[model samples]
Target: MTPTTAPLLPPQKPFDPRTATIAIVTFNRSGLLSKLLDSVLEMEPRPGHVLVVDNASTDDTTEVVEGYRERFGDELVYRRMETNTGGAGGFSEGMRLAYELGSEWIWLMDDDVEVIPDGLARMGRWGERFASVQGRRYDFDGSEFYWQYRLSIPLGIPIPFAPAGFDDSGYREMNSGCFEGMFIHRSVVERIGLPDPRFFIYWDDSVYGWLASRLTRSVIVNEFVLKRTREIKQWDMGTRHLNASSDRYRYYIMRNRGIMQQYFRAHGAYRPALFAVGTAATFAKEIIRLTAVERTVRGTSHLFRGWRDGLKIARDRSFQTMPPLV
Candidate 1:
């Protein structure tokens, strides 16, 4: 609970949704995207704007979003990237565009999550208090989704298990973040820069949130602001859970460590020997999960490959530290 010691700014103001822009990054899953749009349409007070960043989906995603154009008008914007840049890239584009639109706050999400009627308004409650914030979410089964509030960047792990019931403050300080429902102020973006697209997928949000925590008081509130529209097969691990993953997912899960290593080293949090041990331990944990939970190492080779590639990435001298937007 005492992990993040960043100074809380004084004289915070209440957040207003009308001054915030919602950015959803989508790659296929038009059905889920449509439902999310419908949910966004019903959000109270309404957002300043909704921008859908299409990651060159081959499906009818364009048509699905186009259907809502008449009702949304200029309030809705759609930008299709020429190439599929993955979740990390799409979010980077979304945040940059949303900032260009001059919105005071930028809310980032994946298309798979449906917005709650009062989601943005709920986040707005903490707008004046903190520049960066995340809200709670529910799985499609209507169960509370488990998200880590604090992360141990040096070890590349979360500091705690599930939260102890949201507590008295109604919010918990967070160093880890979920892109599914991250609400952040433009000033924070200006101070820390946008989410790095190089991650391509995994650990991107965690690093971004941790960096934000370094600059301001970033928290995850008690409010259920988003509901995951898709269901993931997961194994119950005590109060926490591990989502079943695919080969692609597994590759990124480990391979992205390369990108994370560079960032952590740049921030002075990476210790060579400690990071190596932590990474080896991470590999072992995944192997144990595959053997005990899934009972199969079907794509285990990819994990090894990703680990090798990630090491290569970590040592690339061309890698540069993330730059600030200002």
Candidate 2:
């Protein structure tokens, strides 16, 4: 008897930029948001729709969005939340709307970055091959953002890859990607559903990216799409780049780390004892970095409190499909 093999799939059709929806999640940075919108509008083959999810900014975010609405008319859709939903919520809602609008591809980004003129075109070129393609981000100083690397499943940390290793003709498979300049296909969204809004902030993008990787192939494209305009001061701890994040950020980091541990344990990604050890190591490293580098002990309490709450937080199975944004 002859062994049978699965039939080869047909080549994917070329992606159309006009079928893509650019979703920008903004907080109080109205000026940066406006600049980002301007850059998006200037793309040669502009996305069919630009969905701006305002996280209830207290500033003139509404005014800035209104100006863009006047210029782009219906092409720009601004949805302002009644309250701040953080990055997780904002992206979830924006993605839901984009999906409902029937966009073939949804590009997620933050207001702090500006897309290069040919960014969409480059992403479109690779759209046929990968379910999710993350473009490289350059810092304002023209340096590559080295920290935006693939996540190491066991260590639960981003592992940096050399820039020269990228292939210009295709993408390299990745386990995870950041929300910034992440171009996702509609089919991937249908498979994985939406990012868990309960995450509030930290680890949400990582979890969503990981979920997509489990269902379909996700890759990092060699082309540069976005430039991070803001400069983040970081105290390097050899392998980790510890940013001087806020107390709130610290809480989310610790809490989300716990939640992620639960996720890994449930999926058999790691043995419970091994995950516990890794968690303890992660917590210890964070505390040491905070004390030695930041010269501050203010976030210690928040860190412990977050760890406690995160372990108690329930696992959300409903993240497959996002609820409608009110």
Candidate 3:
């Protein structure tokens, strides 16, 4: 068993009915977006509010949302961005809106998902005692565990498949699976703000959760509530090069991680040197592990670019900025 520490939750305060609002960012995915909305609307206790930020999708995502508005009434609020602000930008807007609307918590997710009913019910039960916690669940299968091929560890570790809370307080760093659905408390957001918009894609979720963990406690519940499209999973590990899309993600992952380590160091909380080394090695593994077919066909270059970009970003920015996700 992992030695666990209890999270220092914010001072006990009166529970507000509208404690949390669900926020999802959508871009060019109409079909998946509809399913995600359906799952949340089906929640028993239901979200206090549901907000969607349309990132200038060309598709009729707005039409789908209009249908939901008629059915959901005031329970759902939709915002359309004139330009595509990417995932980080959309998340920032959604979270900021949640705070302004008096949400005690914000449940964040991408549009390509479907929440299991029981998973949400369990999260509510955990929220009673904890300020902010992420419910653990399979990517698609609720009964089975979700697995991922990783570089840090030789064999891929299962995404926390357990019964209830499994003492995650000791886990200083954790990944939010596929960045689908995770419950975050308002207090954590009030302290950490939203994800860094500079990280348009990758590492934004990790950066947000890292800061939140510093402010309050976070946990991964053992209940599944999301499914990734076939293409989405492939895109996650698609490249390691620095380009308009892929390279930017690599840059942020490397640079933001350095920023995280430095933040801890400044607080007199120096982590193991292996922590940084291991991270870089894992990224390298991600680059090399690609099959021959993938290399020739897909042109996977994010790993090499990540190393180069990590150095550049680290050299440029030493500490994370306040009012940013840090």
Candidate 4:
């Protein structure tokens, strides 16, 4: 069966950058966060306000933000969390504040990426036509980030698009998107609510993007907008790119599959056999990578534990409402 498509948003007034708020979530990456803020400040038509959620960084993040405040004045709004809430929780708080601040559009991103000078303006043009839109991301070396692909629910894997999948003339519908350079409108947030902070990390953006797709038209605009500065070389398995993630990341990634499963099952889109096969395939890949590349089977236990625990995680029915940040 074909995937559900987002309906085109009704025509509205012309795009205005001043009505947008850029929401950035950062954790202990003060240097990179400074670069990202510099780029955002250089936008041709800068956003009306920039809301930053510092995820309890034990670094000079506060000092870095203070420098920006002196330069940008009241255009910047900074909130520092008392604990590390991870990416999921940080974004939830930032988006919540942006909505409460009366922003018409909220552009969400991480602190490790630098926005292209004209990227926000171009995205605003598409925002006039679509309720939710995402711009393309490129690597520091200027290559397009190849892994930004739509997820195939049946296979539980990302489906890479051919060159033709990108259309310069218009937006392409998608069911999933990353937080990096994702532009969400106020109406979509009102309809679907804030992203579930329970995820605390992996797959949170995927689930939130999926919710947006179901509620309204979400698309990926065919324009390069943000550049990923960090370079992570994944294990080059012949058929797949196996990430050599840390023990903590491994747990979250494996465990988050259960959350995705719960969401799919409730939506009547679950394919049990296919998901099981997919899960097995992932396990095999990680095992092979650990033995070959890492030269040890050290953290395989976490993988098993995460998978088992994840399956028991229930779906949060009230995920639409934002939770208070500690």
Candidate 5:
């Protein structure tokens, strides 16, 4: 079940509609959300629907969304969750609503990110051109605070340049790692199911990409649509600081990674050795950085919490989903 396989869509399929519904999951960043929505609404092929899922924000997020709704009307669907479901839950609910509302596809973007150079419209074109293409995402990590993951080609071959034309079978042969920017197709969604809510945060997108790669073809386009938010601080931590740090961030990474491993093993596609190597390297990097930033035991505890919680969650299923962040 490679990613290139056809998706399981229902019968009586209509022509592939160019329209896509954009889902923006927002918390308390009303200013950032307003800016994000403004740019998205201005796209050339404006999304057929703009759906916003507010995660129980305490600030003026409601006011901002209402303003957009007053103007956008039927073109937009704004929803408020009874509790703050975190990013993973927000995406899950938003995607579910989009799928139910007859959207041909879904374009997911973070609330804090701002559109640049009309990237959304361009990415939508690319998604249409190569239905398997996963769209593009890049971080504005600044010069000093940068982060990038190494993408390895098969047989440990180094990929120095982009391949010509996505039509080449080898292009399909090489797997694409999922990053932030994603343009999800209907076929892939129908086959692979929605984003895993159990993955409250962290590796949820990566797990989805890995799963979609197994169920249907997926590739990450190099185009940059949204910019990583820099101005906003950690104001939305809310009352569950422990939940945010312990359960969501640290635990899910380990828990989901193991879950994914078990799933792939059942499918006879287990790559534990490869995962082990990658995980070790990642852990090493985090330890070195954490120690350098603050060599205290407190710092170590904060840094290693993800690893600790991930292990705990992997062992206990009850910890997978926290008590709905109200």
Candidate 6:
């Protein structure tokens, strides 16, 4: 009997910062976005281009960006959306633009973060070990931000960050991603097409990262590269940190589980009963946090609304349009 196996792909060439394009997505955070743009200029070997996707900010976001026009000169490309697309849609739009520009490396981030001076250099030193590379971030108080993850597909969770995941390599495999500081090679984008914009906001990065993991090497390196600028009240949960939730967050967190389940099924990881249990636990946790931590039930209606819509979303056929694993 003869056996056949697919051939292994060769290693990609080392990463080059000059071939990179910085894609920043912002809503109305003009003050924070300006600082991020300032940091971009501070990069010793900055990316060749910077693309800012504005989700139709009513604030002086356009003016803030224009203030840096002379400094950025032709290096900056600003495209303002007609409407707000949330984080999910904005990132998708920004990524699509970067890809179409024929960029070799696309670094995705939000307006709330500023890359540490020389951050790209430290991370770039990794030299392309993984196609999708994530840099760590420091919280508003200069504390370590809890961002690393080992996603549980059926359980629908990003397990709390653990130091052991990094081992001796100073990097760890991750099946989830954060738009705050994700540096993805063009090949990963080419393989996955674009992030599912239907997500609109939540769980979008995880789904995109999951696909990247399935197709190639995806990792979060130990280097501290970003500083989160937005300050928020957070509850310390031993190793991980949870930010106070808003009604918008509550609704999206609940409703997006169904969208999450759709992609899980597309990836052959769906288990309805298990996912339902996970969803229920999530609902319980949010409710408890609402009543105890925040001491208010004002957002309860949004959670219920999102959950009701989520159940309906789980059964929708729109998921079929998502690309299959390569």
The TM-scores, one per candidate, come to 0.94, 0.88, 0.75, 0.88, 0.74, 0.93
Q: What is the lDDT of residue 66 in candidate 5?
A: 88
Q: Which stretches of candidate 1 lie over 4 Å from their true place?
A: 1-11, 160-162
Would you list the C-alpha lDDT of every candidate in the order shown? 0.84, 0.78, 0.60, 0.79, 0.59, 0.81
Give stretches of model 6 more than 4 Å off.
Answer: 1-11, 323-326
Model 1 clash pairs are: 13-128
lDDT of 4 at 85: 87
RMSD to native, candidate 3: 6.2
Query: Candidate 3 on 52-116: residue-level lDDT in tens?
Result: 98999999999999998877889788999999888888998888888888887778888877777
How does candidate 6 score on lDDT?
Answer: 0.81
lDDT of 2 by residue, 258-319 (tens): 66765566555745565566567667867876776688777888888887877665255432
lDDT tens per residue, model 5, 102-176 = 787777777867666577566655554454455434444431111122234111111324342345332332243
Q: Which candidate is the best by lDDT?
A: 1
Task: For model 2, state the Cα shift of residue 318 in Å.
Answer: 12
Query: In candidate 3, how many clashes are counted?
Result: 16
Report lDDT (Cα) of residue 255, candidate 2: 84
Q: Count the backbone clashes (under 3 Å) in each candidate.
A: 1, 1, 16, 0, 5, 0
* Displacement of the residue 6 alpha carbon in candidate 6, Å: 6.9
Comparing 1 with 6 on lDDT, the higher-scoring candidate is 1
Error of 1 at 57 (Å): 0.3
lDDT tens digits, residue span 101-122, model 1: 9989899999999988988877
| CA displacement after TM-score superposition, residue 298 of candidate 6 (Å) | 2.4
